[model samples]
Target: MFKDRTEAGRLLAERLKKYRNDPGIVLAVPRGGVPLAYFVAKELGYPIELILTKKIGHPTNKEYAIGAANLSDYFIIHPGAVSEDYIQQELFVIRTRLKEMYKKFMGNKTPENIAGKTVIIIDDGMATGNTMLGTLNLIRQGQPGKIIIGVPVSSKEAVEMLSKEVNEVVVLLSPEAFYGVGAFYEDFKQISDEEVIFYLSQLQKPS
Candidate 1:
């Protein structure tokens, strides 16, 4: 098991040393991804950005994600019978909250240009990877030079699924016996929004 997110980020950075000084940007899936992506951006001397994507839960079952929204645009609905009205309401609420979050997390900073630049999307880990996939769909529309997925650990099934969508997948561990993302980390505490702000404050702008 890894010590924490920082340690995992350092280890992942070692493998990604080749990308240092390259025209690549690190996009992190906040709240948990901020710390890990902080280390990567520091190591690679790249600017860090946030991918503000969230899963849209079903009306009947809040835990069940019927779809996901990316940066207040682009919604990917699951291939199932979900009420259009429910989806619309969820989209409006989710997008409104996301804009608030983006303002809090980013301040006045605009999103980095992904067009023609290598984009390395990082997270602490992935469970179902639905959130990441949703973010990927948004990223693809920007026409980046390449899209890479980076995570400390993930389920074997998630890795296989993500590999097909992204140009490259960089994972430290992909164990078949995965129960959940937190199971692989020794100190998998819930990341606070304040902690996310702290990490974002520490990011160095690309030179």
Candidate 2:
């Protein structure tokens, strides 16, 4: 279908060009979102930063995220990911790891910077959307003026669910036969920490 994630990101950037001169920031979910959000940030002229969070995977299946956790003083946990018993047991470990991530990436900065500002949250795509939902909930407490969730492609269910959560939602494709986020792209390799560091370093924030 599409040549690769870069081309798809360019196309998605074109659609979001109107935000270039507007007051906004593109908060990207790291790893996969960096490439797509990098292009969008380059085109949109908004600074891009990682919305750091972790998937609270099932007790056994680590890859399968039953819920998600966003740590920055306060953490938003998803209920469906596990039961209360599991959460009570696992919260400390997740928090400790997240703090380590915060120190390594964000340098223990306060997460209140996005307050009262327009935030454009970008991701490569959305599937179950529980992760993003927790993201929204976590940031909403910071009192952003408006939240716009953007993605290049998503399933019908994800699009529908996300639309009701944010002020504006942009989705480029919602194929009925959606299998998974990786299926649409030719290169779905995991994005490395070095790449994330490189892009964030290169992005120039308007003063």
Candidate 1 per-residue lDDT, tens place, 114-201, comes to 8998899999998888777777887888899989899999988888888999888899998878888888889999999999888888
How high a TM-score does candidate 2 get? Answer: 0.84
Which residue ranges in model 2 land beyond 4 Å of their true spot? 58-67, 73-85, 107-112, 204-207
Pairs of residues clashing in candidate 2: 66-81, 67-81
Write candidate 2's Cα lDDT for 1-207 as tens digits. Answer: 455678777888888887777777888887788788888888988777778767666788766666566654334354455567777566667778777766765665555377777788888889988778767777887788889888888988988888898887888888999988888888887888777777776774444
Which prediction has the highest TM-score against the true structure?
A: 1
Candidate 1 deviates by what RMSD? Answer: 1.9
In candidate 1, stretches whose alpha carbon ends up further than 4 angstroms from where it belongs are: 205-207
Task: Evaluate residue 88 in candidate 2 and report its C-alpha lDDT on the 0 to 100 scale.
Answer: 58
lDDT of every model, 2 decimals = 0.84, 0.76
Give per-candidate clash totals: 0, 2
In model 1, what lDDT does residue 34 have? 84
